[model samples]
Target: MEDKRAAVTALPALFADLVRCETRLYNALNDRLREQHGLTTAQYEILRYLHDHPEARVADLATEFAAGVGAISKGIDRMENLGWVERRPNPTDRRSSLLALSHNGSDLFDAAQKTFTTRLTELLADLPALTTVARTLAHLRTTLEDRRIGLPAG
Candidate 1:
């Protein structure tokens, strides 16, 4: 027997609270990286991808990031300007360029990887309901991926 007016007020608050919670987590993680290594979340993502795929091209990175070529190019330009990445001509395509982590980039990525893994483990260790939370998130991710691929859940 809740009043519709009361329920309407609560809905917006609940949605806003969820958004704020997500933003807070992203900011906290970003601040940790900024403090420890002066790297942004986006930069870290690109570096990690390049490290894994070594010599990945701009087109591939663009597709993987789901960003436009200009956005990926801008990120690469910034990373390259900082000596964290390098781009060489693609052997098969004159118009495309391949990106790879430079020595400095690899060193930085290795350090950040350890730091992120350690901190995340520590964070999870202190949580009482982490197992349930992780399972729920995994299930949600799988559901979303399946939907994206046009597969019906049985």
Candidate 2:
């Protein structure tokens, strides 16, 4: 009975630590991307995803990013205005367009990739248990994704 109570108390603290760590890492990465590439972390993520998955629709991106369609649409709009992404007609679905990285967007993503790697390396260099922690986090993320837990439905 005592062991069960201890395990329950420890689990929430572990989750809280995970959340705090994620927030810090996100903020740091965002700051570096903003400073070096004039892009937010979210924008970089979108561009990177589009680069790898060409012709993905906004809904697809929203699902991948665990964001709402409206939010993804707005981000795509801003990127479109900046000529970072181009919307092409989806031959199969006329109502939904496909997103592709523009020439400039591809260039920016390449640069941002270097910045992201460098910044992340610097931030995580001191963590001796990075591999174990990363594996745990990956498992957690996969579990959450499988369950669709806490994610907004598109």
Candidate 3:
């Protein structure tokens, strides 16, 4: 038991390292996006979502992003005011409306996407074993999301 504990001494700190990495990456991306396109990373992601999933509702975005509906609605309001996205009556529901990107939004997304990709690429260029890390993180994300803890040993 003593040897096992010693062997895994670094395991406890892995979560901290993961969080630090996420924070650094997010800040870097956000800064780059804002400087280059006058958009925050979150705003860019919302535009990206609208670009890909046209006619989606606020609830759909909230669920897709794991955010609150009110927060998503507020974000939509801001984007609508910016002329980046627009809402039309939801054909399927009276209480809800569908969202789509405006022409300007599409154009901005394309330009910002290039900056985002370039910055992300530059940041990740020094990282090793990208594929392995990505796969492991994906599995861990799914495991955590499914709440698969404290299960049967088998």
Candidate 4:
């Protein structure tokens, strides 16, 4: 009972530590991505997603990013202007359009993916329990998705 109480009391601090770690990692990655590829972390994420799931709609990206539809639309607009993405008329929905990576986008994503992977590997290689930590995080992410509990749309 005492151990249970102590563990429960420690939850908030543990959660905060998790958030801190995530923020630091994201910041570092974002800086490297911006410098090496002229891409923001968010932009890279969108491109990466589209590469894996071509012809996705704005709503799909919004849901994946846990962001607002309007925000995703604005980002898509910017990417389109930069020739990183292209929008085609959605066959089933006249009001919506399908998004896919442009040639430039594909090239950029390929390079960015390599850089991202290398940087991530370098960062984690020194961590002795990296595999265990990764598994734990994956389980947490799956549980969150299963419970439909996500970060609020930005």
**TM-scores for all candidates?**
0.71, 0.94, 0.85, 0.93
Say which prediction, candidate 2 or candidate 3, comes out ahead on TM-score: 2
The positional error of residue 86 in candidate 2, measured at the CA in angstroms, is 0.8
Q: Which ranges in model 2 have alpha carbons more than 4 Å from their true place?
A: none
Candidate 1 lands at a TM-score of: 0.71
Ranking by lDDT: 2, 4, 3, 1
lDDT of 1: 0.81
Q: What shift in Å separates residue 126 of candidate 2 from its native position after superposition?
A: 2.8
Candidate 3 yields a Cα-based lDDT of 0.88
Please state the error at residue 134 of candidate 1 in Å: 4.1
What is the Cα-based TM-score of model 2?
0.94
Q: Give a tens-digit lDDT track for model 1, residues 97-137.
A: 88999999999999888766776666557878989978976
Which pairs clash in the backbone of model 4? none
Model 1, stretches more than 4 Å misplaced? 1-21, 128-154
Structural RMSD, model 2 = 1.4
Q: Write the per-residue lDDT of candidate 4 for residues 37-65, one digit (tens) a residue.
A: 99988999999999999999999998787
